[model samples]
Target: MEESQEEIKRGLKDVAACETRISHVDPKGQLYYAGYNTDVLVGRVSFAEAVYLTWFDNLPSQKELSDFESSIISEMNLPEAVIKRLKSYSNSNHPMDILQSEIPYLGMHDPDLGDNSDSANRKKAIRIVAKVPTIIANLNRIRNNEPLIPPDDKLDFASNFLYMFLGKYPDELERETINKYMYLHLDHGLAASTFVARSTVSTQSDIYSGITSALGSLKGKFHGGANERVRGMLNEIKNIEDIEAYIQGRLDVKKRIMGFGHRIYQADDPRTKHLRELCENLCRRANKLDLYEKSKEIEFVVLNKKNIRPNVDFYAATILDALGIPVTFSTAFFASGRVAGWIAHIIEELNQRIIMRPTSRYTGKYGREFISIDKR
Candidate 1:
């Protein structure tokens, strides 16, 4: 008897994507890059340094960190042409829509995109990482009808981004909060959006193409949409008295609560603990602990009844709210941090040079003759 061809499984959840000297996760679902735990790194390192560590597999020295910071801050201003193109979009368009359009447009201006060599590709990766903050901040400004500000050399990358986006330098507490937010979002283990980025670049597509694909996937409601939904949930609750009833009503209708439950984390999202601590501190300092209290109440109710815990989106919304970012721009802020991870994954895929094409099991009949128009 002839043996059937070995059936290769598509979307192999059990299979490992890469075996390398790169990052890994602990049994507890916590992530590490190049032997450093993310929790330790977020506390000890700046957002830019963490990003560099992820891509380069080591923490940068003082001079290298300065130069990398300088390069990233230098590219924080979008070209006028890019801004002009963004203005052409209707005000009704979501900022993600604008991002999806602008990321691919980077290819038109970046000459390094044409060079597929490893060194050139790495440079291109840095360019993508550097410029995406500007693109995302510019989109926020355009949406608000505010003028864009060029990056200030004196400010660190995270600080300059906040300054440019908000027209002023953030206070020490505000700056630290924003840095923590960026650090927490720097990477997640092979999320769908990151996978999309990897898959696109695996085909030898340029960094711009890979990022554009990732942005498209991130724009979906199941992904980056949680931040926006969390704000909506907060708005619906309005007062302390309404929290329980509001949640109970939604639960009664079998509605899935936003900002709780993650695809990868069964018990709790590891990112949540860090963000929650930062937000709680910020809220306490601002005398807005009531908001955080309300959030905790909601958390208790959800966990007691539904066994769900708050994900990154839950505390992220609270932190951004405390930072005075508008609800509309919350997801844009998410895009800011995720762009770093997207670029890193894109570079990794380009280095490996595997086309990520997968086949679907054929469901249609194979042999069918087409009828002629005359017969029909």
Candidate 2:
């Protein structure tokens, strides 16, 4: 049967599949998490407090934040078996693939693996958010044949992840940059990865399974890995003078200018404004302002030619590069922050108690008589 085009919602664009209290991207081009504007929350709140707000629907009090932060750091240690497994993998493996595969393996060791109670799920969420940074940092170290650095409990969430990754204490500037990055990435309402997570756990599957599914989804080029591509784009343009010609050439060929535009935001990605400034400051301090300038040129060219604005990933590529993170780990950095939001969506989906089972429209012919294979 042929259905009208109006009946089809490709990509489910603007489709409200379900309700969420965790976050929102409004038509007015602002992002909110639990009624707080993300712009307001990014610099002021610690990433831990932001995580707390996403999961619990409000910001934590001082004592609550302290306890929550401690709980996260305490769980950052990877099991010995997991470390050995990470070592066994080929260094050629992508970080996101390694992270995704290890999550289900980690699930096998969870004491409350079978429990889907609110309390149990919350605990699982903590373990996931905490361990993800450890997994990514260690994977990088293993690939480079360097000793892994353990998480520093004295440092807060963002600070500790930087410490583990860089093998040193981050200065206040670095700490502030990472906290803002993580907070900006903490959640977006029903993002592709978050939706995959919710759909997985909606079947009452384990939280680890839900998270694993989410990691795979986040690895997609159109989603989390766009920053890596943006970085690659930056490398392709060798000089500041070549940005326009390079962008125009790519556009003339109908190639996507990575890190530009968004599906949800018509004006500009609200997250881009903060990241743009952050990238500039980090690059300025690192004496790598050239990278920031090139990024701005690309943004300006794309905006002038296509009328499309830069999304969060555009400036994030420069910021991550300024922080000395390899392009390979870019999406893993995304997972490190987004796993919190995925868990929040998972917990909320569990409460819905309905499996996500959207049906597809079939356009093939029907009621035709079948012929036996021998008849032909």
Candidate 3:
């Protein structure tokens, strides 16, 4: 008789775990948020509007948007204790590490801690989205021995982050670039970090714990950190002449190119088109047009040789670089935007009321008998 076995889907590839109405990642490279095409949402809505849509399942009216924006801005100031805790960390500490460590402390200061009611979670979500940028910008400033810049209530969400990070109001182009960039990343299908967030909340945990777990996952190079890796790859090539040789050399050793392919999206990532345009314009304005040209050449080579298209991380790196961001802080920016998506997923997972426990295939010998220690 043949032994019975179960087929294993490594990495849960193509396994449908649960149904969600929040976003759809079509295998054909189209993305929709709450049934509205991202192409329509990208320029039409602000990041705060998109966050409202993700959480509430529809776009908000003018009055509602104003109130929502005010709610988020009101919570932007961190607690004194949390600020003190952030100041104590070494300047050498990675920003994501600082972010992960400080979240629980933020939860400590939450008035609604331990309350998982929908209203309470909604309030918690606002706090998470509002303070994440403050945390990242403040940490960067602290590392540079600069005094922390307070969030400006006058600016919108994306603009305020830029103002705090750079210590000046952004021009129109810079503000639009960040708005589109962050809106594009608001959510995708069950990405590694999103899945980690859903899984954490599946145990009925608090919102902060789930976000902390997601942060740890996002810090890996293959995930959110890919943007940072892409920036490093760009720095490695000295000039346009070095592009082809560098790509072929990496390919020759069977090394994975940091930003050329995605686990999903066989065609060009839908988000890439917007980001490519943004990168080009921002690079030109920042006098880094040379970087944009080199990025295009690298994309052409990787596509011609490997037949793989560049993902969101590829151009997103250049966009941040053009904005004067250090490569080390790239993923923190990613996390800052992505916390909105993570919060939405946590809310959805909590509603499912089912803990996420999957079975594993046992490949080792299962019938081996254990010998007593005395016998040995």
Candidate 4:
């Protein structure tokens, strides 16, 4: 029995080698990519540059960056079939669900689906990244009964997304806010949904199908649901004065605050600080400093008394609120950024060609006598 137990442990420890490059956490739980710290990257780089780095593994020259932007902008139109399929979903269906269906539909439209060579795969990756924003923006427009605007090649990726979603050019600050938000959400350290994407692709599934599965996983409450909950919590509070009492009441009942905790970073989430700063600047510019102050008050109360730090969703709610992005569309916007990382991982898995299958330990007896359906 001891040897059997040892065998079980060994079976459980069988891990697969995936070639997809992922940044490791240092002792401090800080994430890095290819020798550069995320904090440094966030400070020094535009979101477009970060996405380029994630795909190509190097910073682009000015010309290269310009060409990259132009390439993505050129491919930003979704096929008409995809748009028609998106319209079939009810207006009340979650945007993420619509996204899940739309991604697989994209696979059907991809011309190079049969081409597995590296060059073809790379081009497909670019198309997926470029078109995901268009797909998500179109879904939002359809749900709201608004007219869908085709992508404008003149605008950068983030700017075009803002225009498509809002039907006008975003101001400089709004454009920057969208860019930063997209950049920050591009990837995390192999999150569960990301892992799901990799695992699906590891089975040699197409990239769009893998990402569709990932979108379904992300739609769950524990993953992408926090942002929506944060908006809901803010709505419930309704006024600045009610925040403390409201938070205290929730804590008294041992309820989980929507954006207070994180599974990976036990201290504070590093991503929160940059977004918070952006929110602060935006609020100041908009002459709505009072709202920012109220949010900060809640943050102070939550941190000092309960030892909870606001995660990305807390500040994301504020940033989207300031930019006039509706609460329901926030998670879909998150998907727009994340689809790049998903495509990257999917392509990486296809290159590595490793199957990800884990063994489960059986807790019940292996053999049992068959019984009649009505047996006592």
> How close is every model to the real structure, measured as TM-score?
0.92, 0.97, 0.97, 0.90
Give one digit per residue, the lDDT tens place, for model 4 in 216-295: 87766667767788878877877888988998898899887787776667666777888899999898988877767777
Query: Which digits, one per residue and each the tens of the lDDT, describe model 2 over residues 1-376?
Result: 5563447677998788889999999757899999999988878999999999999998999999999999999999999999999999997888899998999899888898999899998898999899999999898888888899998777899899998898889999999999999999989988898888988988988899999999899888889989999999999999999998999999999999889878888887899999999999999999999999999999989999999998878899999999999999999998889999888888999999999998776767777998999996
Question: For residue 313, what is the lDDT in candidate 2?
Answer: 84
- How much lDDT does each candidate structure score? 0.79, 0.91, 0.90, 0.78
Candidate 1 per-residue C-alpha lDDT over 1-376 given as tens digits, one digit per residue, 9 for 90 to 100? 3334555665565456644444554545577766787867777888898888888888999999999988788766666788888878887777777777887787688888788888887777777777777876776777778888888898788887788778888888878887879988777767778888888878888888888888888866677878888888887887878887888899999998888876656567778888888889989988889888888888888898889888879999988888778786777788888888777777777778678776655555655889999998
After TM-score superposition, what is the CA distance of residue 208 in candidate 2 from its true location, in Å? 1.1
Candidate 3: segments with Cα more than 4 A from true spot: 1-4, 367-376
Better of 3 and 4 by TM-score: 3
Worst-scoring 10-residue span by lDDT in model 2: 1-10
Q: Model 1 compared with the native: what TM-score?
A: 0.92
Ranking the candidates on lDDT from highest down gives: 2, 3, 1, 4
What is the Cα-based lDDT of residue 9 in candidate 2? 76
In candidate 4, residue 338 scores what lDDT? 79
Each model's total of backbone clashes? 0, 0, 0, 0
